[model samples]
Target: MTVTTRLAAAALLLLSLAGCEGMSRGQQRALSGGAIGAAGGAALGALTGGSALTGALLGGAGGAAIGAITR
Candidate 1:
C-alpha cells in the first residue's frame, strides 16, 4: 500500500481504539469486530473490483452479530 493509505489506516485504527475508553466489554468487542471486518472487507472488495460499501456493510453486520453472540 501507499504511504498515505498506510497512514490513514493507522490513524483510523488509533481513533477506533481511542473511542473504547468508556464502553462496556461487549460494546467494545462489537465495535472492534465491526471495524476490523469492515476494513478487511473493503480491502478485499477493492482487490476484487467489487463494491466496498456493500462489503463493509455486510461484514459489519456479520461481525456485530458474531461479536454479540460470542460475548
Candidate 2:
C-alpha cells in the first residue's frame, strides 16, 4: 500500500480508539474490540486483495458480539 493509504488507516484507527472516553465498561470493550477487529480485517483485506469494507463490517460485528458475550 501507498504511504497515504497507510497514514489514512492509522488515522482511522486512532480516531476509532479515541471515542471511548465516557462509556461504560461493556460499551468500551465492545468499541475497542470492534475497532481492533476492523483494523485487522482492513489490513488483511488490503494485503489479500479482498473487500476491506466487507471485512471491516464482518470483523466489527463479530468482535462486538464476542465482547458483549464475554462478561
Model 2 local distance difference test score: 0.84
State the C-alpha lDDT per candidate: 0.84, 0.84
Residue-level lDDT of model 1, residues 1-71, one tens digit each, is 99999999999989977878999989878887887888888888878999999888888888877776785
Which regions in candidate 2 have their CA more than 4 angstroms from the true location?
1-19
How many backbone overlaps does candidate 1 show? 0
- Model 1 scores a TM of 0.69
Listed per model in order, the count of residue pairs whose N, CA or C atoms clash below 3 Å is 0, 0
Model 2 worst lDDT window (10 residues): 62-71
Q: For this target, which candidate reaches the highest lDDT against the unseen true structure?
A: 1
Candidate 1: segments with Cα more than 4 A from true spot: 1-16
- TM-score, structure 2 vs. true: 0.66
* Model 2, residue pairs in steric clash: none
lDDT (tens digit, per residue) of candidate 2 on 1-71: 99999999999989976777779889888877887888888888878999999888888888887777777
